[model samples]
Target: MARFIVRAIFAALGLWLASRVVPGVRVDDTGSLILAAVLLGLVNAVVRPVVFLLTFPVTLLTLGLFLLVVNAAMIGLVALLLSGFHVDGLLAGIVAAIITGFTSWVAGMVIGDAKRD
Candidate 1:
């Protein structure tokens, strides 16, 4: 639970960074940004695998690059669900995915899989 919250905070940071750097990605405010982060985490957990499985053929054909589209789609889905979060186009979503992906990678390194009792 604590780990999840920490990761969500990091995800919010990435989203905030994306909003600032990407012209087409707009987050209305801090509240919306936080909501987007939590919503993104849920969407990625519940929806991404199914979408990935469904699009595996295209993803394979693209030599795995299409996963970027998949990731972007997940972000776009979050945007669709939230009024305050907006991704203007596929290009912006893709860029946001890159930023968020990097953030998650760093987060994973910081918060490893080791368990403590």
Candidate 2:
């Protein structure tokens, strides 16, 4: 419960960072940004696994590079679904995805270990 909230906050921060760092990726307002972030997290959790599984062969063929495209698609999907969040093009989506992913990874590191069973 608390862990999920924390992860969502981190994901929001990552999206905020992406908006700042990636040109053509824009959030109309702070509230919209946060909403987009939450939606992005939900989309990733719900849809990403299926997409990943279906693309496993392409992922392998590309030597893991296709993950970048998958990430970009996820970002693009968020932009399409969110009214106030906009990603201009594929390049913008890719850059925003990279920034968001890197920010999330760094945040995870800083947040340290998750609770173990």
Candidate 3:
């Protein structure tokens, strides 16, 4: 539970970065941004696997490049589901996803390690 909450916070930070860096992505408010982050995490956890499995053949055909499209689609789906989050188009979604993913990766690298106490 604590780990899940931590991940949600990291995801929210990613969304915040996305809103700042990606032009066509917007979060109406702090609350909306947090909600979108949690929703995005849930969507990735639950829906992403199914989508990946269903698209496995194409994903293989593309030599894994299709995963980016899948990630963008997941981001777009989150935008559609949430009231205050908006992604202007596929390109925006892709850009937002990349920004969010990069931010999350950096944050994980910094935060995942425990300090000696």
Model 2: lDDT equals 0.85
Write one digit per residue (lDDT tens) for candidate 2, span 2-87.
Answer: 65666678778877887888888888998988888888888899999999999999999999989988988998899899899998
Q: TM-scores of all models?
A: 0.95, 0.90, 0.88
Q: Which sections of candidate 3 miss by over 4 Å?
A: 110-117
lDDT of 1 by residue, 1-117 (tens): 888898898899999999999999999989999999999999999999999999999999999999999999999999999999999999999999999999988898888864642
The best candidate in terms of TM-score: 1
Compared with the true structure, the alpha-carbon lDDT of candidate 3 equals 0.87
Better of 1 and 2 by TM-score: 1
- By TM-score: ranked, best first: 1, 2, 3
RMSD of each: 1.7, 1.6, 3.3
Screening candidate 2 with a backbone cut-off below 3 angstroms (N, C-alpha, C), the clashing residue pairs are none
